[model samples]
Target chain A: MTGINTPSARHRRRTGRLDWIWFVPFFGFTLLFLVIPTIGLIIGSLTGGHPRVTLKYLAQLSQPQFLDAYRTSIALSAATALGAGLVGILLAWAAIGGGLPKALRPLLMTFSGVASNFAGIPLAFAFTASLGPVGMITVLLQQATGYNLYHHGFSLFNFWGLAITYLYFQIPLMVLLITPALETLGRWSEAAASLGASRWQYWTRVALPILRIPLAGALLVLFGNSFGAYATAYALTSGMINLIPILIGQEMTGNVLFSPGLGDALAVGMVVVMSVVFGLYLLMNRKGGRWAQ
Target chain B: MRPARGSSWLVVLLGAAYFILPLVATLQFSLQTGTRPLFSAYSSILTASGFWASLGLSLFMALAAVAIGLLLIIPAAYWAYLRAPKVRTWVEFLSILPFVVPPIVLVFGMVGLYGNGFGPLSSPMVLILAAYGVISMPYLFRSIDNGLRSVDLRTLTQAALSLGAGWPVILLRIVLPNLRTAILGGAFLVFALIMGEYAISSMLGFNTFGVYMLLTGQTRAHAAAALALISFALVWVFVGFMHAVNRGNITFGPGAR
Candidate 1:
């Protein structure tokens, strides 16, 4: 209570007793479910069917299958995040300052709300219906131009295909997170223009600097989002793609690979990658949020 | 102004195309894919055996998860806002921790820790429910925290305290009722999330709606398209409900990340 919103001494004294009781349920539940489970995975990743620690699973991660899963997943997440970050900033810029109809802002915000949450399986199937082998787009392209999509190495089960699927949510998320940052750009632009700077000069010299942090922060978030995603890609590929999540799934169900310890290591690797990106996001966002507010 | 306006219009339209094209395609596919009559795919899916069971299980779990999640998040977030800045910071970080841990990995950890069928979390339903509450921590916590941010809790609590209302009475009568919109917003968002969740349920061998949709998609493409639209509409309805309850104030849904 001491350093709350108003941090006054009397207010601090009145609430001197730390209200830690209210946090018990939240902490207790998370301790049992989230924290403990994570610790278990870390320990599980180290051991091989025994309580004592070993490095077998750790060594297994160096194999092509596991290495490829980690590499390909990172590549997938980065490509989509970078792609979404660029396009999303453009879209956010257009919405907030485009001088189009004023009505589009709320509409796009609402749409973004729906589209961002509209992920997981249905999204995968929706894309499949639109672009699968016999899908509408594929069929229409074939009929219209005598072009066969699957024949052209454009299968819905491949890496690029999954990137497009992920962009469906990633773009909206980027737009959503970066819009406030974009909204604040106008005040600075007006200031710059009033000071006789050209719009392009203003952007390169002023606006872009301010936006770089938030944009990077947003991209980091998008990377983390897609990096942690398992359901969408799994639903689309049905275990065809050798992503980390798919590998983890295989290990868990004992279908193709049955090493639970390896799965634990994969999970731990995933957590580390995501935590690094997320930690960077927090650091950037703390500085970036200064202007947006 | 004229050039900027034209380019902006183009950009918005292009983005709109990417957003709307799949929806139009899905609707067209759902309508024409099955037996002769329109919406045959939908009708067939409605009559499918596992459809009801999976959908019902997901819905039931959504309610259970929401009930349990709100119970855990609101008080902690509320008190953090009022009296515990350190705890608030810690909870906010924990809330977003779910975002860092993938659903599959979280369940992987859960099974590794408690797969012995000895603890309270052995049952698939219980495990999935707990996993959901954890996965949904980000959205639920964000939504309620947004609500808390909008309220003047200091003045409200102080006034309630001056009126001889105890902590329970204040929390129940004043705080809860005032936060009704926000809590409901968080609940509906959580509802939408759990409805479409796949990995945890499927990994645990639970027949949730998402698992059912994937199965249908493999066997029957047309009915699967129907399920896709139904799934899409459910998300829209629930997210739209969140906005409506908040009177058009969008709460970022799962996009809070």
Candidate 2:
């Protein structure tokens, strides 16, 4: 009787000693740096002041100014994601089927690694000098063709300008993420063709369906990547452009006085948008895994 | 398997042009000062006031971040790999959370929470390093997890335990040596991220290399280009080092000498 225990208790005794010791540092760091601050933001955004709850900040999200910012941010990210996703698939396809020099693949991969991470201020500077009003390309084009790039409506500070600048990093990032998926396509395509499928039929019925999940997943990632970006857009436009991150920066960094609670609301809104995007990403990946197998 | 090579070359050439044009333009811009040598802009950065300081501060911060990130990740990864494999998904989700939660948002929260409670958290150095450590968690965790996956962690631990080896001896002597490549890979990523990180540091008012470059871009365009090229070179070196280490991993498989 002393040695015997109920089955449930014995089962619990065998598996219930949670190995939480190794989690101490991770949980501590996350709680301090990630969780607690986020929680604070949530609380801050919810309450107008101490000991009183208010929806003022959340309600501010409906105002026209905030709406415009959201619109521009979403539009920019969607455009960039679609563009980068399509171009990246092309680049990856070429790397596989383009019959470039053998050394080209590694070289392209290395460059993509650098370019993908090569964002923020320096990237903005490169684009400004390369495409700005008095930039080298502008000056050269003016001298050769006698056409002002700006007069022709190609300013690097406007919406198109930002989109182009975003592509610098976006395309390369897409290439890196999609290359592995593309590499597996050749085998799958061969399998489909061996089964007597025509080229167009193979792509439409078989290849495209298989790639649909990963393609959508990559596009969502690109959207999230651009949506969360701050430094590049901020540097290029100096917060003049109405984007979510820029709007958040302006709200928090007011020259005279700042609104911490309002800023938290904005940050929370950003998290919500990103969460939706990532949720779709997760769903696509899950559905795509079955076909991938 | 090689598809027709026609359109692929067109696409590759177009990409190469788009990628290389700005670099060429930047190089030419950096060399535009008539009196000095073509490398004068680079030389100027070497002699420029506070350039070294900013670069030094960034390096120190990056090093600290890598150390902190490794300290936090290695133990958790090792334990989870050996004991509670079910927790790996949760850990992975947490690790990648930073991507969805942008640095700007996190720093905003930091300002509110710490700026109110802890005065020292407002210090530029402390806040930026903490942010970097958190931001680098995903890469560090993935690499180390991949490394641990390559090795049979449970079997290694059991064998070491059966040999009367202590936990410290097993981890430090046996595990650490086997994980050299992964650690290096993660460290390179951390270094690159820190070197180019601008949003948090700029918002937090830290004088890192990125901050310095941003400030320079405001006034001296050529100098900014020079710094940009220099930053590009540094990133290239890190990528090259990573590639070399990965190539060396040919011998890292099981039973390899």
Candidate 3:
């Protein structure tokens, strides 16, 4: 050990060796649990019950049934992401820059933290109780203003209904993620104002360009978040709808024509879509982060 | 300024209303029993065997997942910060991979790999916990790493080393104590996430709290509402507790004012 005393080799054998060892557990566990499962998914998707690698299932993704599911899910995610982003940015802007009471900020944040994490069946139930058919608000509005929510085709089981339910978490999530970015906007706006730009001009020209990448990133996040959502949609529609997650769940659980391999294909398809969106999000975030510096 | 202030109030009010309305409605619905206000739903859920059993299972799972996450994340994050800076990026990416991979997709992979009806991954508890650990990794890593970021790790490690303390002593006595708030924050988030998690457990055929809620939702409306509110309360408790722990200690960066 003493004879092999080159500086680089010593450094490598001493500190670098132990340092790399620290990563083993994290990477090993991740590889065992996360990476293997993902590889399983990919292999499972490409292969079939025969376990021989084939592109048959990958080709299944383009079928009308599967394509329709993807379409509905994408549409739902896009609507919710866009809706949540606009409203969340508004809410965050109001909370940060709005001339409201100073005490409200912390309260808003605590609530957002709670609400953003508040998902699954309970959240779906909350929305159903409020806006579902025969719900309190639905009944109240019907009796008070002759606005029959159900009769008017506002069922809480369709794409729009699911999108609204998603906003319960999404809007707050948007608020939480976008708030820090919003905090950095103040000095930029003041600088613009000092340059004799009007408020609208400051927003449209200065603020918009600066915030573009981050906002787009946030919306893409919102998109991916909703796109991957399964439980809420499943609980709300009970697999009546053909969303991709529901379809995968249905196939996985053998509720309808169990094909484990096809389920894998659907899952693989979802990962591809989510990965593309997430890649865009990361790209935008990198650009935004660079701009911030 | 006046108009901006007015619109701000309006926006905040409307956002608050959107958030609070469902909760209020659910509470009212849970209290209702055949046209009379009552605690029947609450009592029924409290006495239900499945509810308790599932809730207990979920609690155990959440704890186990948090422990596993802490064991894996704290050391990795600490080491990355101190000596292995290159590993940090990979850890961060893997931790957040759960966000990209839907729960259903992960479950599909699990079923594909381990649905063989034998082995460690065959057990619902082991499989769900492993999956839960992965799902909770992002939150746990983010919170703890954020906390670690607020501490001067290099200086502290060097200080502890120069004081004649070993690595274990430095980590256990010096680093862990300083990271109390971060650990608690991460643990709380992990707990909240595990308790509310539905997709993995439900898909894996486990009777966790979230699964029980979904099952109860189909047949029992008021009971489901009560359980929903209870779940919301559980999350609030965790968030509130974390908020309290992080109240004055919210550091934006190392030595940041």
Candidate 4:
């Protein structure tokens, strides 16, 4: 590829001037629609109904309810991320370690891609329909063994239920993100195994070390993904779940403590948490890229 | 290798079953015929007015959004590839911000921005803009970026210029043709997202398919199941079509008979 370019040609090329006219519409759209609105949200969090600009809204976030919501959000997000990472790593291992038929790889990849995006309300509905009072599984169990899942308080509208629904997407996403890492390891580990290393030794000394950064990075991305999720939780419990995203939505929609300022503060808090997680993901991605080289 | 193969098959079957179980249940619910709840939901949804309207609206919005997104993204991606490679990362990041930020937060921010006289609120246009700008980002950017990376942009430009072709000709005749599949994939993904998107549209008060589903769930359980099944089928069909296209490309090697 480098041979196609000459030194003289490379030197003579100037930094191409951007056609501003071409970008004007897109820039205007993004700036006005996305950037400005976000700025408004930030500012809205600081000021009250009179726009006096006070820290009262941010301070209000310290209340027990808000604090509990934050804690729940963090805990659920962390658990989901960890679950996704472990399942993803194992699935990737199964796929790339010559565990599956080569013909099925593409099929699994496509299935995973679709499933990963298949979350939110539909997923919640599916789970509810399958496990709720009239759910198929609940009905089946009741008929066969005289034991009703819902009659015994087996509702798919609580924290554990939300986490399970989350895994529906989280696991698939992790699989997609980690598969390439596993594939890359396979290429090198095959050679190491050929050099007389046992399977355990090969994984311990070769594959695991190489995959550490990417695996962690993928987990961080999952953490951020689940942390920011709201639609699923909202659909399941209608903002009664008390997750941070649900709390933010409730505040914005005038549910409890319907202060736009407080809502903005919660939004800012969410942004801060996700931004940090995403930053770590970026850092890990950079390191992973370097390691791949 | 042999034992691993057995376990892999087991895992694949289990995974596929897990993914399909909810869909199958929903389908069964949709196809029931009794009032006692065998498949009454499906029949009611099929007979409902809101179901069809919401489905039509979702398809319309998704198509419009995809068209608008392609129009903007193709040029923007091409321009970035040719001129400002250094800022490509920033542009990409900006495009994907909607994905990273929770949909609730994005909707909140959007409502604050456009819910007033400043922009179109409670209108399809705002939803279109959101769809075009936010959901289409990852798909379009990845497609265009991958397409750009696969080709020799400089050589193509130079060849086109040497033959007295303008930038427009090169972009239309050369670059776009090469990036057709990528563009199609991106467009389809955007379509799927828009079709299935519930949070933003529902929050904004537009009765798209997803919103309709939520509403149906509230009012008529059986009808909602039917609607959900219909949506699942539509999305499944689209995903399957894309996969077929991708598989066909793989077999034909991008330029085969």
* Interface C-alpha root-mean-square deviation, candidates in order: 3.5, 7.7, 6.2, 7.2
State each model's C-alpha RMSD to the native: 3.4, 5.2, 4.2, 5.1
| Candidate 2 Cα misplacement greater than 4 A, ranges | A1-18, A256-258, A291-293, B1-3, B119-122, B247-257
Q: Mind giving the per-residue lDDT tens digits that candidate 4 earns over A73-149? A: 99888998898788766676677664566867777677666667666667677777776667777787889999987
Candidate 3 or 4, higher TM-score? Answer: 3
Model 1: DockQ vs. true structure: 0.56
Across residues A12-53, which tens digit of lDDT does each residue of candidate 1 receive?
Answer: 556567567788899998988899999999888899567889
Candidate 1 per-residue lDDT, tens place, B1-257, comes to 11287788888899998888888888888888434799789888999879999999999989988888888998899988988787899999888888778888889898888887656777777788899889778878877888888888768887776666667988998789888888898889888888988888888999999899988888888888899889888988998888788764454423211
Residue A257 lDDT (model 4): 69
True-vs-predicted CA distance for residue A213, candidate 2, Å: 1.1
lDDT of each: 0.84, 0.80, 0.82, 0.70
Q: Every prediction's TM-score for the first chain? A: 0.92, 0.90, 0.92, 0.87
CAPRI-style class, candidate 4: acceptable
The window of 10 residues in a row where model 2 chain A has the poorest summed lDDT is A3-12
> After best superposition, candidate 4 residue A17: deviation in angstroms?
6.1
Estimate, for each residue in B30-115, the C-alpha lDDT of model 3 and write its tens digit: 99898554999999999999999999998998899889988889889988887767878988899878777877888778777887
DockQ of predicted candidate 4: 0.33
Candidate 2, CAPRI quality class derived from DockQ = acceptable
Calculate model 2's interface RMSD in Å.
Answer: 7.7
What candidate 1 gets wrong by more than 4 Å, as runs, is: A1-19, B1-3, B247-257
Q: After the best TM-score superposition of candidate 1, give how far the Cα of residue A252 lies from its true spot, in angstroms.
A: 1.2
Docking class of 3: acceptable
